[model samples]
Target: MKTLINITLLSFAMLFMSMLNAQDTVKKKNGEVLKVVVKEINDSQIKYYHFDDPNQVLFTLDRMTITEIKFAYGKEYKEEESIMTDDYFTEDQNMVLSLSMSSMLFDAIIISFDKAIDPKSGFQITGKLLGIGFGPSFENWYNRSGFDLEVGYKLKFSGLKKKKWEYRPNHLLSGRYIMPSVGFTTYSEDRSSSQIKKNLIHLGLKFGNLKIIQKLIIVDYYTGFAYFGGSKKRTLNSYGSDVDFEYNDINAGDLLGSGNFAVTFGFKVGLAFGQYGEQKEKLKRRK
Candidate 1:
């Protein structure tokens, strides 16, 4: 009777062990069910260990290719795919809008638009309106007004390959960049009874970077110098049938510099939204 009772207990233990060993199943989207033990689950992938292997080698599969995880005890877990990727230079995130006040911070507004040509380069255009309606009361400020249009291309250094460096691929507008641009500007000075207008052509170099938050907010910091050539125009009459003007200090010279160079610097804060992010979400849902 003692030996028979011991045999019965051993049989019950084996049955319980077999039941525990087959406690989980990984179901693929194709309707195949894998009877494996699940070790972990995340938005990107699922990790598990097989039942027959003695070493318990782990395997991970992308959640997009999976359907659901069904446990032996009747619990089920679904997979979710995250839409954001490291590549941000695609259509939705590639375009940027920025505004910077650079002309002595007194009475100027600069608006810029940028488009990523690729992962490592981009193109930008800016419009600067100077002295619209603000008054310069500060000691070192000048009552100057102007309009400028500029075009430039940006080259990024972080896009270069490095040794043992691990970074997300195609991260545009988020690193250090150097840009060379050409622009034209018309500046005016208000005198007691007349206005002095100057037309300038400038070449510039800009160095800057942009930081993004939650894929929405963008913070831009930049500085540069422009070599310019200009010609002066004196308006003889403000408003009259006999309006007159005089041209002075006019010169046709090299594009580099014939007039002077000025420092350009400013900060810009703006928002970012696009269809690329939405497309990723749709793809994730469809998969």
Candidate 2:
């Protein structure tokens, strides 16, 4: 409930601010500049006004045209570059403590699938909130959901030095699954069953894009190795050599255990919100 509320309030505030600035234009020191008026923002390449600007002008982002974003009044983003560079993320040690949330279209496992196994394979929207600190490379905490924590590490390499892009492969040791039950009875000789979960290990690759005109935001396309899944497990009876199996009404705990290799592939898109400025990233881009 707390998480939901926080997310709601944050979203509403951001949306409102964006709307209020739709007609405004922002200017920077360098020849590169941005124009913000009311609820609109105009850049050297494109202009965006209102939420749904059908006649909006869009421009191709050019490396040379990119410059540090300056705000009128006293506005700030979530993260800052000086904090990332002069301190943690810098030329000698490029690292950052990052946080993000994501939604996915499909999240499935690599194994073969059928109707039963793929029942929950349709579509899922999940969130990832993690902080990774880098030193030699980058490493930190991966907090998935409710104590589903993991020790994560990542290594990244850029395809091009001038663009705002990066490819990273990350690995993490995640907590086990703690399944909830529905209702069922198991009579496997000794009547053993499963409603609990287990721990897992996973690896993933993320292609990331960083946008720094206003805030430090990240948009990433990601997929992982172990496809963790959620389901309502139900345990029943087993049949004899020639007899038929039987089942009975059960509670949440009656649900049995099953291999959770995720119904579909592990995929999601993530975004990071900030309340400060990133000076270091700006300097790097200019270079």
Candidate 3:
């Protein structure tokens, strides 16, 4: 009788141990751990039920919030190990403010704003404040003023799933892209004897690579060509001598020129604001 009682107790203990081993464990990023019976897992979330509850009430949690899951059958799923197949950009990382370095060479400050519509595409606008920098001061000879505006559509060709598990999460707008742009520029120089006015309309296509550093700084390098069409006109006063009129050549190191067709190549450097800026501030506070 004593042997039988011991045997029966051992059997019950083994059954309880087996039941405990059948449960799954969920670990959250916030240091919470839960024992559950996993029901389903999709791309964005996971569905599960409490292992200890009698009613088995279902619960759902975002996959981003979870760190890992240890299954009952000795399998494991880690959130960090999963590959991002689509939509790599977050809402906070979608907008960028930048300045063109090459534009400063032409005595202009070109400020650009890019807003991402989706993970793969976006649009940008650039405003040029001409006659600000110290490229070639025309103040001694003539007063110069101009306005330039450009709008472009960007098609991103990176960070998408070309192969399995090939995307990096921090690569926001860091890759190759093709941009088609249209721009208009107008300039007027006022002198005592003559007034010179020039206008330009250009359509361009650019291929570029954008690189992001520390999730905040951006460097963009591009080369392309533009077709320019406009008129450069001068009005002469009574005292002014009228010779063969020639327009001031728009030349940048023999690479960019003013004519029917112009070659365009430049680099831009700037900081990414919005969410990335906030994150940098938070890190400073923590330190």
* Winning candidate number (lDDT): 3
Question: What is the C-alpha lDDT profile of model 3 across 6-111, one tens digit per residue?
Answer: 9999999998998775899999867899999999999878999998888889999877677789999899987765555434454246567888887666666778
Query: Model 3: how far is 85 from its true place, Å?
Result: 7.4
- Where does candidate 1 stray beyond 4 Å? 1-92, 101-104, 133-143, 159-170, 235-259, 275-287
RMSD values for the candidates in order, in angstroms, are 10.8, 24.7, 8.2
The residue-level lDDT of candidate 1 at 195 comes to 64
lDDT of each residue in 1-287, candidate 2, tens digit only? 99999999999999898765554333332453455322323332333343345565443332223334334455632211111112211212121223322211111111101010011111112222112212221111211121122222323333212222211111110111111111111111212432222233322222222222112222233333332333223333352232222322111110112343321122222232321125346656899
Q: What local distance difference test score does each model get? A: 0.65, 0.27, 0.73
Identify the candidate with maximal TM-score: 3
TM-score of each: 0.56, 0.25, 0.65
Q: Candidate 2: misplaced stretches above 4 Å?
A: 1-147, 163-194, 203-215, 227-287
Q: Which structure is stronger by lDDT: 1 or 3? A: 3
The residue-level lDDT of candidate 2 at 193 comes to 35
Runs with alpha carbons beyond 4 Å of true place in candidate 3: 1-16, 23-42, 46-88, 136-144, 162-172, 189-195, 235-255, 275-287
- Error of model 2, residue 242, in angstroms: 22
- Find the 10 residues in a row with the least total lDDT in model 2: 108-117
